[model samples]
Every structure is written in structure tokens, then in C-alpha cells.
Target: MLACLLLAQLLVAFIGRSVGPLGVLIGEDLELSKSQIGMLPAALFLGQAIASIPVGFVVDQTGSKTLLLLISLCVGSSFILMTFSHQFGFVLFLVVIGGLGYGAMHPVTNRGIIHWFQRTQRGFAMGIKQTGITTGSALAGLVLLPLAAMYGWRQVVAAACLLLIMGGVVSYTFYHDSIKETNQDKKNLASFYGSMKHMVRNKPLMLVSISAMGLSGSQLCLVTYIVIYCYEYLDISLFLSGVLLVISEICGSIGRIVWGIISDRLFKGKRVIILMIISGIAGVTSMILAFLPPSTTFGVMIPITMVFGFAISGFNAIWMNVASEVVDTTFSGLSSGFSITLGSLGVITLPPLFGFIVDFFGSFTAGWIMIVGVMILVFMLLLLLLLEIKTRAAY
Candidate 1:
């Protein structure tokens, strides 16, 4: 089941994250501005944000298997349709369709973990599962850009969508829900309202979710612009810049698994401390990028991108674990959904704003600085959350 869930996530993430690696190609083909290029991913996240909360409710009522299958078909079909798009507006519309499916992924997967894994094991399980995201992005960085360069962006997207569709079929055939729903487990509108009220009133959950807005925004910015920054500003070849993205994603995959182990074994399932550590690492890396010179060597970039990926790209697993655990197991999907909805806000807004800053300033420095400020905000919010957790324990 975990394997199937991971596969499904990987495929969906491939489609969702494809925009980052393909951004330059798409911009060149369509004659798009930086902010317009940024808007492509933002549209996808906007669709995701719109769908997350409602999908969370649906996941609780139904199960993940059906939703997982639907996500594959939805995202795959959307990307396939994008191959027909000649204009930026049409492509954005299709991307939004894909994002709607992307939104359901977390609620379904998080709920699956909550149902199947014990609390002691969930951090690691969630980490292993979340690596599907970075792995998918890595695959995109590794595969799609080269394929697009060789064949064409449209053909590559269409081919990838076909693979995603096949994976969905396999996931549906093998994966079954661990938890069985009974009459008593059924929820109504009143129950949803009650859940919403409870989540809103839950201070720790809210703080963590809000902090995720910054962390998530910063991560998206890194993914969206890092390639462009390397290629355009640092005078790296386009292929080498894509290689940098692949390296970052590979390191991110490693970070997710490593941090999960730390939370489960070393921290004994405490998530916030690890989050604080991630925030600090992310902040420091962003600071470095803000001042990174154009003449910097590829060798120098390697370690910097690796550590940056480890922190910024690696944070979601722990964050999702925290969101799911803070609420009732029954509402794990809803809590994850709510947190993602808030995080999606960051994903939607930050990339375009980061691009706009770069466009206006004619450099990537201010954009990197913006990410540094976001990390600082995340660090403070996590600190407050830690204090709240400690205070509650004291009482």
C-alpha cells in the first residue's frame, strides 16, 4: 500500500513539478516574461488550494484508493491536454486542472499513513512516502528537460502523461484501504463544521500550518528559479543548470528520509525541533544565494545546492507528520488538507512575486533575500509553536 501510494505521489509530483524544469523552454517557446512563467506554476497551486479542503473531507468519507486513481487520470489527462495548447492562457488553464488533482495527493497519502502506521513509526513512514515528491521532481529534472531539448516539450509532456496513466492503473489494482468505514464513522455537514471549528481553535496546529506557508513558499521559489538563476546569472550551461536541479532534488529525497529517522528515533517523534533546524539551514542557504557571485564555480555550487535542497526541499514530511498528529486520527486527512491549503497559498503567491522582483531589479539577489526573510518568519513561528507545546505539557 505504501509503495502504491508512493508511486502515485511520485507520478503526480512529476507532473506538478515539471513546470519548474521546463519553465525556460516554455517561456522561450511562448515568448513569456519571467512573471508569466512563474504564473504557470502558481495557476497549478491555485487549483490545488481550491481543492484541498474539500478533498480532505471527501477522503475521510471515502478512502484513498479511489482518490489516488482519480488523481492519476486527472493530472495525466490535464498534462496530455496541455500538449494541445499553443497559448500561455490555455496552458495555464490546463495546469490548473492538473493542480486540482495534485491537491488531493497529500490528504489521501497522509490519511493512508495515519491508518496504517503507529505513532512511533509514522514519522519515518511519512518521510519515506514524502520522498516520492522529491524523487518525482528529480526524475523530471533528470529526464524531462533532456527529452524536451531533444524531441520537443509537447512530446515529452505527452509521453510522461502516458506513463503516469499506466502507474495509476497499477496503483488501483494493488492498493486497498487499511481502515474500514462504519456507520458511526460517517461524517455530515455539522461534523465538518465542528472539525473546522476545532482545527481553527487548535493553536499548535494553526501555528504549524501558518509557518508552513513561509516554508512552502520558499521551497517553491527555490524550485522555480534556481535553474534560471544558475543558467542566466551564473553563466552555467542550461544542461548543467538542470543538472543542479536534479542534484538538489536527489539531496532533498535523502533529507526527507534522514530527517524522518531523526524525528522517529532521536527526537522520539518530536517534529518541531527538526523543523526549527530545517528553518535555520534554509535561512543560511538563502543568505548565501543572495550574495552568490556570477563567477562562482560549478564545484562551489554543488554543496550549496545540496544543503539548500536538504533543508528547504526536505521539510514537508515532518511538517505533514506534525499536521496529521495534532488532530484526531479520523481527521488526519482534513488537517493535512487544511495545512496544505494554507501552504498552497504560499506556493501560489511566492513564485510570481519572486519572479516579479527579479524582473524589476534585473537580478536574482532580492528574490533570494525575500526567501531569507521568509525562513526567518518560519523560524519564529516554529519557536512559538515549541513554546506552546511545552506550556501544554507543563500544565
Candidate 2:
């Protein structure tokens, strides 16, 4: 069951990022301008953001098992349909179809892991589970580009469909819908509204949610634009930079597990403090990398990117774990859903906005500064949250 759940997340990440490595290939094959190619990704994210909360609400109503089944079917179908796309709008539409599946997975999986794991072990377990996303993304980056290089984009899309079909079958046959309640339960609004009122009235958790939005915004912008920025602005080879991005994701995969284990044991439930510290480190490092001279190379930047990935990656579980504790249990799915949706606004606005900054200002410097600034603001909010926690406990 555990292994099956993990496979579900791996496939989730794969379907989510299926088109990214092929961005350059898709452009050449379709005779697309940079903006047109860029729109496909933006469309996917916009679609995902639109779908996430609704999926969560549905999961809260029906159950994650049904949602998981829907996700697998959607992924299988989306990839197959995408292969037939020949025009820009057609491709964009196809990508949005896949985005709907990817968006649905976020809340479903968050609630699923919460149901499956114990609170005491959730930090590490959820972190390990969430790494499935980076692992799948890293694999797609390694495989899809080369597959496109040899077999053409259509064959690659077909192959993705085959994998999704297999994964979907496994998810349906083995995944048990019966979940033991963890720290959260009660999916109804009688519960949800009450939980919302409680969470909103709690100052510390409110601060944590605010900090999470800022951190999420920064990470989304960084991940979405790093590829384009490196290729377009830094003049790095696309294939090589793609490989480096995969390596950084690999580091993130390991980092999530390592940090989770640390938080589970040594941090001893100090996850919020740890998150604040890590966000600050990522902020400082982002600024340094942004301002690096042209003399700096990809090799030097890989480790820096890895550090960014690590710090940023751990926050997903850390924030969700905190959400489980701070809010009324009934609302974890809804809270996770809404916070992730709020985070997706960065997804909606940041990438193209980053492109606009680069296109107009003629530098990634301004863009990086904006991203780094968000991280710093998140760090400050986390610090204030810590103070609020201390003050409340004192009473």
C-alpha cells in the first residue's frame, strides 16, 4: 500500500511536468515564437490552479480513491490527446487537459498522505512522499528530451500515455480508499466553516499561512522561469541546463527526505522554526546567484540551485504538517487546497512576468531580486509567527 501510494505521487509529478523538457523541441517542431511556447506552460499552471481547490473540495466530499482514479484516467487520456495536437491553440488546449489532472493531484495526495501516516511520523513520511514529484520531474527531464531527440515528440507523448495507463491501473487495483484518521478528519462545511473560523482566529497559524504564500510564490517563480532564464538570459545550452535542472531536482528529492527525517527526530517538532531558517538561507543564496557575474558558470550554479531546491522543497511538507496542527482537522484538505491555490497565483503571474522583466529590463537580475525579496518577506513573517506562538503560550 505504501509503495503504491508513492508510485501514485511519482506518476503525478511525471504528468505534471511532461511538457517542460520538450519546450525547446516543441518550439522548433511547431515553428513557435518564444511567447507562444511560453503560453503552453502558463496555460497548464493556470489550469492547475483553477482545478486544485475544487478537486480538494470534491475529495473532501467523495473520497481520495475516486479522485485518484480520475487522475490516472485523465493523465492517460491527456497525453494521448496531446500527441494529436498540431497547432498552437491545440497544443495549449491539450496541455491544459493534462494540467487539470496535475492540479487535481495536489489536494488529493495531501489528504491521502494525511490519512495514511501518523502525526508523529508525518513530517518525514510526507516529505518522502512529496519527493515523488521531484523524482518524477527529474526523470521526465532526463528521458523526455532524449526521447524527443530520437523518436519525435509524438512518439514521446504516446510513450507517456503507456506509462500513465500502467500507473493508473496500479492506483485503482491496489489503493485502499479506507484511510485511518490522522490529525485531520471531518470533510463537511459544518466542520469546514467552523475550522476556518478557528484557524482564522488563531494569530500564529495565520502568520504561518501568510509566510507560506510568500515562500510558495518565490519557489513557483523560480522553478517556472529558471529554465527560460538560463537558456534565454544566461546563454546556457538548453540540453545541458536541462540536465543541470534535473540534477538540482535530484538533490531536492534527497533533501526533502533528509530534512524530513531531521525535523521528525532532532528538530522534535520545531518544523516551523526550521522552515523559517531554511527560507532565510534560500533567500540569501538566491540574491547571490542572481547577482553573480557572467564569469560564473553552470557548474558553479548547480550546487546553488540544489540548495535552493532543497530549502524550497522541504517547505511543502513543513507547511502542510503545520496546517494539520494549526487548523481544525476537518479543514486540512481545504486549507491545503486554498494555500496551494494561493501559491498558484505566483504560478499564474510570476513566470511571464519574469519574462516580461527580462524582455523589457534586459536582465534576470531584476527578476531574481523580486523572487529573493519574496523569500525574505516570508522569513520575516515566519519570525513574527514564532513570536506570536511564544506570546500565546506564555499566557
Highest TM-score: give the candidate number.
1
For model 1, give the 10-residue run with minimal summed lDDT: 177-186
Question: Clash number for every model?
Answer: 0, 0
lDDT of 2 by residue, 14-62 (tens): 7667566567678788987545655656777776777876676667666
lDDT value, candidate 2, whole model:
0.71
The local distance difference test score of each candidate is: 0.91, 0.71
lDDT of 1 by residue, 322-351 (tens): 999888888888999998998899899999
Q: Model 1 scores what on Cα lDDT?
A: 0.91
Where does candidate 1 stray beyond 4 Å?
180-184
Name the lDDT value of residue 79 in candidate 2: 71
- The positional error of residue 46 in candidate 1, measured at the CA in angstroms, is 0.9
Lowest summed lDDT window (length 10), candidate 2: 177-186
